[model samples]
Target: MTSTGSTIEPPTTRAMVGASVDQPDAGIARRRWMSVLKHAGLIALSVVMVYPLIWLVVSSFKPNEKIFSDLSIFTGDLTFENYLHGWTSQQLPFSVFLVNSSILVLGAIVGNLISCSLAAYAFARLRFWGRNAFFAIMLGTIMLPFHVVLVPQFVIFRELGWLETFLPLIVPKFLAADAFFIFLMVQFIRGLPKEIFEAARIDGAGQFRIYSQITLPLMVPALATTAIFTFIWTWGDFFGPLIYLRTRENFPVSIALKGFVDAQSSSDYGAMFAMSVVSLIPLFLAFLIGQRYLIKGFATTGIK
Candidate 1:
């Protein structure tokens, strides 16, 4: 009894509804597959990156003869003898080397934070006569390699009676010798909204006051980034310590670790690896503590 047009409408409406449902489900399934593949690739890369550190840790605990024989991290039997031997057999007390390294790293961090932040602020916010010219010169210095200036630096330190002392390692940081760190801070500062500084100025705040009260509070992340880099670099520096530290007593952990390399005998791979692992602990802890600051800084600063 239904009309012909009415009879055709029901089937047409059902077909359209079925097609719409199928299209979205199919699209969602494809997107979910793509996401799974992306995550799988990332997991594989992470595993690859972490494998070597695992191997190193495993090899450190392996016996000298078995270290090279077994590449599997979990298969190796663990031993603490290598660590004990490494700790006890050094000419320079390992503890003293640890202290020396800590001192140098701390001094460098403090120096870089103060000097670099000040320089960056000047470069970012000031209106001095030769500000642009000075910044250009500073940028130009970044091109010069550390090796090119090493001998000159050595001679200057020697003339100043700073050779064979921590001064050679720590003094250059006070001079804003780290052009890259300064540049990083400058870029980060530039990315901040100009209105913040303007508002502070209008409220009768001086430049120094603004820097200490406002800029510094906002710059926690950048400061942490600079501090972490300074600490790691100062801690791991071998050549500078090798050149400046003549006495075994003055040797940092980096220099003392080199003593493990025997000129005529087979090197103790197990002990060396154990010491290397031990050396990594402080730097690892440092990064863990400061990582939040670094993440927050990058997020807020909008610096690339």
Candidate 2:
């Protein structure tokens, strides 16, 4: 104080220590609460979305009278009678429809993989006159709705004597009828390194040799994706079969499921629900088996 002096604040080590200790605790507490809230929200949404499917599965085991009377998912009484009756309730065994759907799906998968991939390869790798014009036209077809061509296609198939047959359903796939799949594969093929194709050309490899040996092997992700989607779409197709197939024997599961309903009499709700569950099995299995490839395909092809 005797000399010229300025005031100096004392260091509060206690306050600094308290703040440093409290900050970490506050941040960790906030993050933990946020995580808990996020998980709880997800679980709630999942329950809401899955409730209907659970109800359907439960109703399939209940007698028709009890289905509407008791809305609860659980009951003291349950029966397997619906499944037994549903398997044989129609004119033909349910197995017949399953087989028909399986055959159609198989054909569609093979056709899309072969024809669409080839078309995509040509559009992506091969050079020709008016290539861009042709590609533009193909993409334009993707924007066209299926219903716009339904009547014309029906007339053409009838003229070709393909009505009431699986030919109408399966043959179009062989002709690269699905433009969306072709587009998908084209994008995937374009992503491949061009150097490899040039090297193969230098080795005197023909287009077919290049496609079979080099391109096809690397296109597994795209091919598997195509197959899985083809199976799902063709298996669940009801309208196509309904228009062309008049005979019950030729009906796929999608159409045969309609047999459970009778306009003049009471509908077999229990059996219908049972068969509906059965129809979903193949779709579930296909997804589960090929989900990895599906994810990979989307990632490589830049499709969301």
Which runs in model 1 stand beyond 4 Å of their true positions? 1-34, 262-266, 293-304
Pairs in clash, predicted candidate 1: none
Which lDDT tens digits does candidate 1 get at residues 1-304? 5443324444555556435543556555766898999999999999999999888888888888888877788773789988887675676557888999999998899889999999999999888999989999888887776898898989999999987799988888998998777887888788889999999999999999999998888877688888887887889999999999978888899988888774216568888888888888887887798877656655654432
Whole-model lDDT per candidate: 0.83, 0.86
What is the Cα-based TM-score of model 2? 0.87
Per-model TM values vs. the true structure: 0.83, 0.87
TM-score of 1: 0.83
Best by lDDT: 2
* Residue 63 displacement (Å), model 1: 2.5
Candidate 2 lDDT, 1-304, residue by residue in tens: 2521111213563445335543546555766898999999999999999898888989999998898889899887889999999898877999999999999998999999999999999999999999999999998887887899999999999999999889999899999998878988998889899999999999999999999999999888888888988888899998899899989889899988877655317577788899988998898898799889777766755533
Q: Model 2: how far is 239 from its true place, Å?
A: 1.7
Runs of candidate 2 exceeding 4 Å displacement = 1-22, 261-264, 296-304
